[model samples]
Target: MNETTLTAGKPGQSEAKNNKMGRLAAASSIGTTLEWYDFTVYNLMAALVFNHIFFPSFSPLVGTILAFSTYAVGYISRPFGGVIFGHLGDKLGRRWVLIATLMLMGVVTAAMGLLPTYFQWGILSPVALVTLRFLQGAAIGGEWAGSVLLTMEHGRQDQRGRNASFTQIGPSFGTLLGAGFIALITYVLTAEQFMDWGWRIPFFSSVLLVVLGLWLRKGVDETPVFKALETSENKADLPLKEVMVAHWPRLLISGSVRIGSDIMYAILMVFTLTYVTTILGLPRSEALTATMLGAAVHVFAVPFFGSLSDKIGRRVVYAMGALGSIIWVFVFFFLLHTLNPIYICFAVVVGMVFQAMMYGPQASFITEQFPTRVRYAGSSLAYTLGGIIGGGFSPLIMTFLLKEYNQSLPISIFASIGLTVTLLALFSAKETANKPLAE
Candidate 1:
């Protein structure tokens, strides 16, 4: 089936295709949105709430280290999520796997809201928090590749970049919602009330979003590409095994490609929240507002770059973003260092735009690298593993660096090093646009 994102034609055919693709895109987006929202929300809570609530016995610095350490543990579990859900995705279907992940995240995130603090549950509290984060990470592990493929496979070959990018909107939306929701909660409540109950509101609200996601996904058919793969009876019973054994090189490239974007996102979106508040002595609202504004532009930037990739090729756009960010990281810090809100917002928005360039095309880029038989497993593993390498521990690393060196330059330099690796991977990756979707 040939489908266009924009089509004005016979109501019965062209319009139907467009509607179908639109619905699929909408449904796919919720998973990614939830994934990133959860990731972002947890980052905020770790920096602001968990370090104090869950690890009250430790020094503030050590407590934050512990909070973020739990955050990193969540990333460590993504591969398990990838392996489990990816096997089911490749063997069973994308639609159900997505629904399953949504269900899992909704439950876990809400559970996080109900968790007892250290003052209440002692060691059991943090233990439970870690367990929930682990489970939450696992749910997100399957979301990225599955969501990207959800729309990409249903659209026209030539427009795969734009189609895949439709789902990429999740991260920015997630960041926006997470930051916006937390910002609102913080604004309304006194700091004491916020620490006690306000943070739980956002986590509880995730239940509603998950319900909406499930409703949107209901009755949605599996992607035509996956359906065809199923009919061919070419399914890999253990898709993760096949991917690891047969496509490790592609896996390396795909995973490395994610490192820069993941790290950049963690920096621009997540770490800055910590930096601005703890280091600069700004109000939490200031940092939240900066990150939120940056994510707002990122929402538009993603599709723009995704479409650009179709014209200029993925490598050019992806590498451009990677290279641009390497240089921009320093400028980003300089702007932040000035202690000007206007400068801070400007730095974050530009930094996010550069990240968007790579992220916009990433879904199509990585998914196109592997055959449909193991596409879910291959793409999920790459994404989750890269998050582990870059996004997972970055906040912890940046926090540690600041404590050790009392400077932001090392943080910028460290971020640049990861983007440099991303550029290398972008060069090594085959240009996948205007090519057949691997079967």
Candidate 2:
């Protein structure tokens, strides 16, 4: 074909390409959403019901801490999950591990939704719930890293940031979906009824979503990158060991980049829920509504900034996000302390937007940092370690901080951590813009 004909065909071809990307993005987004739906429901339940339902024997304050501890169980299990599934994903292919993890998460979450409360079964009920939460955590450990690799591997090298952002969008979308579902259930039923039977709707609803996500996933072609590794016979013999031996520095750098992101996530997702209801004395519904709205904004902001990273280099965009997070850290708490619900919502939305900058391009940057032989292991290991160090203790630490000093102390701590990590990640990491995949 002539150059003119080939150039003209690019538009039509581009549409086809985007359609494929959209499908891949949907599969990744929906699977991650359902996985998160299962995981985050624990947080929502922790905030609303777990204290009474699971840990009713403890003092109210003790119950809250205990409930949050169960939430942390999931994050704690993440590294093990990453190691296990990271090895599997690298060896068995991303598609199978992805599907398997989703199934495992769905089963555990549904069971949690149906399990009797501590009021009925006593301590066993809470123990059961904690066990299920751990399973959900491990499954999700595999889910996020695998989903990011799936989309990043399928997309063009130039658009990896945007594509990777789709995976990160899962949390915001899942949070909104879970929150919205709970809101609807509450609206349809009385407060007493919601606490009695209505709270289970969000968890029970996940089955249908999982099936739909699986259906979408079945149609996707395997990632070209994975296939290339398989064909080139360049796959790692011991993926986890290879990842550690060959890519330890990249893994550490990537994990550092995640400290701010994970802390911000906890600050926004878990701690803020407590801050509003306990300290600020806002109604739980108002707090949830504000959080739901902030998450709604993030669903768009993440992808927009992800796409923006396609034009600008990854480092610049990520550094901006980190800096924005540092600024927002103090402001987020200050606004919440002010106790104006509208201001609470505004501060949260802005904070999440800043969060999107780091989150949007992170999966691609992490994945791109390593070669395909150990890509899955490297990505999952780095990402999970970040979650463990950055997020695992965030709720606990924030609680301790608030109890130890004042609210401002937590904000100061958050800003310092965010700024320190942002600067470190900004200066140390290589820019991945226009870099070839599998390089």
Candidate 3:
């Protein structure tokens, strides 16, 4: 097929095509939501519960470090997942690879609920947990790229930013679900009961979400861009190799742009839970409730910013977000220090909104950098690498900074440095909101 034919459908599509795109976006969103729900739950558990359950022998500080280390292990595996799955999604198709990722994530996450604690199995428990976490990381490594591509490739060109935003909202919705569920569990169970078994329920319940994701995803068609690539016999056989050779700079740009937003998210949603309960002497329920509320705001914030990107441009909105992070990091910690639940909620919610401005337009921005033939591999590699730099070790770094300096200033400076990198990257990137998909 020619580029003309590939782009021809847009000018004359009826309401039927529009309806199909809507359904496809919904399915993609639901699948991504489940994927992030499993991920967010794991991060929350790593922060609040895993140290006690899996690394019981260590001192509190050491245990928290070790727990976050295991959390980092998952992130370490993500790039590998991206390379592997990105190649397949580029060479094969988006649909089956996404289904495979969903199943892999669900099974491993549920298995986490059944694992023996350190007391029951000694060194083996943490080892097993880390192994499962790695696999979970790998699964999500490919999930985000595929989810975004599915929606964007199927969506109207003028609305790609808004459509891609649907996928972006997954993390926020997942955060909401994960935090809300944990809050509910904590509220209902005494601390003793919670430590004993409450955490497992969320992990185990992932099976239900997996089934729903599978059902929803299975009903959708492969994206039009991928379909066009197949018809043109232009699919990349070694997508990663191609991406490395021809698009490395764009990959670096994509990853850099994500640093500020990703780090902000990791700190707000995961590390803050630990910071509040441990340092601020707040109740666990209070922290979780604040996070849940923040995530709820993020669900709306992401799409709003995403749609706004459609009008203004991805880079402008994204740079604003990166700049916001550079300015807001100090305020975020200050609000947390106030020990007022209201201030705490404001901190988390407002911080996430700033991050959302970046994340909302991020999907289409990165995907547009590569041609259809290698978009999956290129975008996934950039995203997962960004996760490694920006998110994987953020909590550990924050913990170390706080422990060594005994103040939030060091962490705020660390965040500022990352956002500065993102701002530089935004300045270097082309405005891609109105670009047609490369053939």
Candidate 2 wrongly placed segments (more than 4 Å): 1-12
Model 2 TM-score, all chains together: 0.94
Using lDDT as the measure, name the better of candidate 2 and candidate 3. 3
Q: How many residue-pair clashes does candidate 3 contain?
A: 0
lDDT of 2 by residue, 91-163 (tens): 8888888888888888888888898988899889989988988888889888877898877777666677888
| RMSD in Å for model 3 | 1.7
Q: How accurate is candidate 1 locally (lDDT)?
A: 0.88
Q: In candidate 3, what are the lDDT values of residues 1-439, reduced to their tens digit?
A: 4432323455567677878877777777876788789888988888888889898888776789899998888888999899999999998899888999999999999999999999899999999999999999999898888998888887768888898888898888888898888888888999889899888999998899888888888889998778878888877778999999988999999988888888899888988988998877888888888888888988999889889998999999999999888889999998888889999999988898899999899988888888889998999999999989898988899888878888899999999998999999999988988766666
Model 1: residues >4 Å from true position, as ranges? 1-12
Against the true structure, candidate 2 has what lDDT? 0.81
Instruction: Compute each candidate's TM-score over C-alphas.
Output: 0.97, 0.94, 0.97
Give Cα distance to truth, residue 189, candidate 2, Å.
Answer: 2.4
